[model samples]
Target: MVYRLLKYVVLGPLLRLLWPTKVTGTENIPAEGGAIIASNHLAVADSFFMPVYVPRRVTFPAKQEYFTTPGLKGRLQKWFFTASGQFPIDRSGASAAQAALDTGVRLLAEGRLLGIYPEGTRSPDGRLYKGKTGVARIALEAQVPVIPVAMIGTDRVNPIGSKMWWPRRLEIRFGEPLDFSRYAGLAGDRFVERSIADEIMYALMELSGQEYVDVYAAKAKEELGEAVPLHGRAGEVGAARAGTAPSRVPESRAG
Candidate 1:
């Protein structure tokens, strides 16, 4: 498949060479079952790196704009993501969220890995933001485990304002899976969902060692008046405006 071949041939070799990575708790990833890998978004490189290191093909819901471009560039962008096992999610409207969740649930039902960033977007600072309830809803509804993953040092390689790369060492740590079966019957309750989301964020906080903030990505994006574009130049601009640059993120070895 494209995911395997690309990882082994292109991205994997480059990652191993340019910025040697150290991974922990990779075994925490379920070998053969549906699970949600919830991670904190720190940088643009976060998206590419997470998929590269995971053993199974983990699909993330990307904005539909990545798929619907105006020309050949858009076509290739769409192809790349589709081939990489990522599906498009319209990050707009109430209907879009429902549709996105439906796609994720279906993938889980088929025993596939569904990777999501509950914060919804990369944190301007390296702090773990309050997660949206969508991730919790997905887990509880699908009866799946949510694996907390914390990524460090990606912001250095391709931080907010850079077109080029830097040779920063990257580390990805996968935390133990959190089972939500205990809250299955309470899936539809917003209060319960938000509580579960908070719990997941706490796990990420412990894993990544970043300060926690009680704000969702969408709200943060709005408060900053940032207009996110599809990809390429527009994406770079948005990233820069949003302060996605590398920072002295505080992290320590897990005890």
Candidate 2:
């Protein structure tokens, strides 16, 4: 397929040459069969860097807008996303999130690897945020092991508020897959769901060594001045108060 050709035969070789990435624990990923890669999202480049390093074809859902632009650039962007094996999902609310989770389950059911950032969005300050329960739900539903990935030094490669990529060292550490099979039947129970989610976030925290925020990624984004767009999604702001949202560390602690 186009994705394999682009990655192994074309772009992968070029990116490896240009960035010279160091990928540790490649063996942590199963050589074949299905799996889910739950990574800490730090930078825009996280999307691009992780897939090239994993031998299996890893498909993740990207925002729908990325494929909806206009003109030549739009066409090129669509092509790239298609080649990268990303499908579009509206990042609006529980419905879209559930739909995305369903998509992930379908992929796993068919024996494909699916990548997800349980934080839901990029970490603004590189600290691991509380993971949403969707990740636990998927693992339970699909009966797949979750691979905890720690991405270091990607933020420097393409920092926020910047459009260019700078030459930087990239380190990708893949921790052993975390299994929650013991809680097999409780995946749908809210209490068990939350416990499993917390477990995954803690694993990511231990691997990344970034300050842990007990809040969701989008809320942290708002606090960091990257508020949701005026005409964009509705739940990003007010929904913070809807659920028993996780607590956040003081800014000083995060710094």
Candidate 3:
């Protein structure tokens, strides 16, 4: 298949020779069966490094625009994404969230490793943002464990607004699987979903050692502009601009 050819014959060798990625906790990944790899969204390269390092073929639901761009370069982009095992998803309208959940659930039910960015979008300032509850819903629905992953230094390699990649040493850390079986059959409860999502984000924070932001990454990007203040200070400023009272976010409800 194209995925194997690209990984073993082309992209794999080039990425390893150029970026020099270091990965830990490969044993934590399930050798078989279904699971979700929930990770923080730091940069576009997060997607690239995650799949390359994992032994299993990981599939991510990329935005449809990545596949629908016009011209020759667009076609190549589409081909590369497809070869890399990414599929397109329509991330528009009110049903967009549900659509993504459905896609992930279907993949999990088919016994594949699904990579999901719980933040919904890339972090504007490299700080880990609050996760959306869709990841929790998928895990609960599929009855699979959520494995937290952290991509370190990917933002520096392929920074936002930069078309060129600066090859640098990067890392992929896989944390132990998190089981939410205690909350089984409770996916419909919004409070339970939020708690589960927040728990996954907390694990990502510990693994990545990034400052946690309680607001969603997209909302922070809109209110705080493209450049969010680094560290944990952006939350207060963003909350003020968005007219929400800033409070200490609990670990179990950070999302």
Candidate 4:
């Protein structure tokens, strides 16, 4: 009820009117089923705009801090996230990634739509990054189809570190569902899992029309952050690899 109220009566109308979003290929979404919607993480708005356009409720794994913080401000934030279709997940501890993967699989097993960013974080420079294999693991474990969705121009609407949204054109494109039933029992095989993740990223690249970066976005951002203070601002660096590239070889072309 809260999610519906916010999506239709509250934030949905306001966001659509302000951003002027255009969604395409929504028919690719299954009417009802356990599925994973793998999207290219461009901005925080990607989460907001996606659920507003889709017919079904989308649940994302948000860091626990978003719901557990103290004070009135924290309570408001918690309410908004829950209303916007997000659930808290603890991201601490050595097994955090695996724990999150298990949570996603559980949601899928229960016949819910799960939204995940394969890149694990927002693109540092709007280029698609190499995807983490957790998405593949979840799909295999839950035996669900993975749908690739692309969010275009959301960066302008909600840029990194920006306090206010700048009205801009937005688009969400959905691609055909990817079937990994062939790899059903091979969930824990690292090589097979990486292959699945690479395929998913390749699909995202075609749908999103963005250049594929073979490096992880978080590492790329860390390198950018470290170099920006000394040489120039982040924009000037523009996804500086800073020697993080070429360390690991990719098994497949993510593009």
Q: For model 3, how does the per-residue alpha-carbon lDDT over 1-255 read when each residue is reduced to its tens digit?
A: 999998888888888899998899988999998999998888898887788778899999999999999999999999999989898988787698688788889999999999999999998888778788889899999999999999999989987778889978999999999988877787888888877887888888889988776788888788767654445355554453332222322455333
Over the full model, what C-alpha lDDT does candidate 1 score relative to the true structure? 0.78
- Which stretches of candidate 2 lie above 4 Å from their native place? 227-255
Per-residue accuracy of model 2 over 1-255 as CA lDDT, tens digit each: 899889998988887888978888889998877788999998889988899999888999899988998999998998899789999998878798789989999999999999989998887666667788888899989988989899998888877767898899888889899777776766577866777677777777777776676677787677556543322443343344433334332233221
Residue-level lDDT of model 4, residues 7-125, one tens digit each, is 89998889888888779989999999899999999888888889989999999999899999999999999999987879887777758877888889999988899999999888877
TM-scores for the candidates: 0.86, 0.86, 0.89, 0.89
Candidate 1: 10-residue stretch with minimal lDDT: 246-255
lDDT of 4: 0.83
Q: Candidate 2: lDDT over CA atoms? A: 0.80
Show the colliding residue pairs in model 1.
Answer: none
**True-structure RMSD for candidate 4:** 4.1
Q: After superposition, how far is residue 88 of candidate 3 from its true place, in Å?
A: 1.2
The per-prediction tally of clashing pairs is: 0, 0, 0, 0
Task: Tell me which of candidates 2 and 3 scores higher on lDDT.
Answer: 3
Model 4 spans > 4 angstroms off: 226-255
Worst 10 residues of 4 by lDDT: 242-251
How much lDDT does candidate 3 score?
A: 0.84
Candidates 1 and 4, the one with greater lDDT: 4
Candidate 3 local lDDT, residue 106: 92
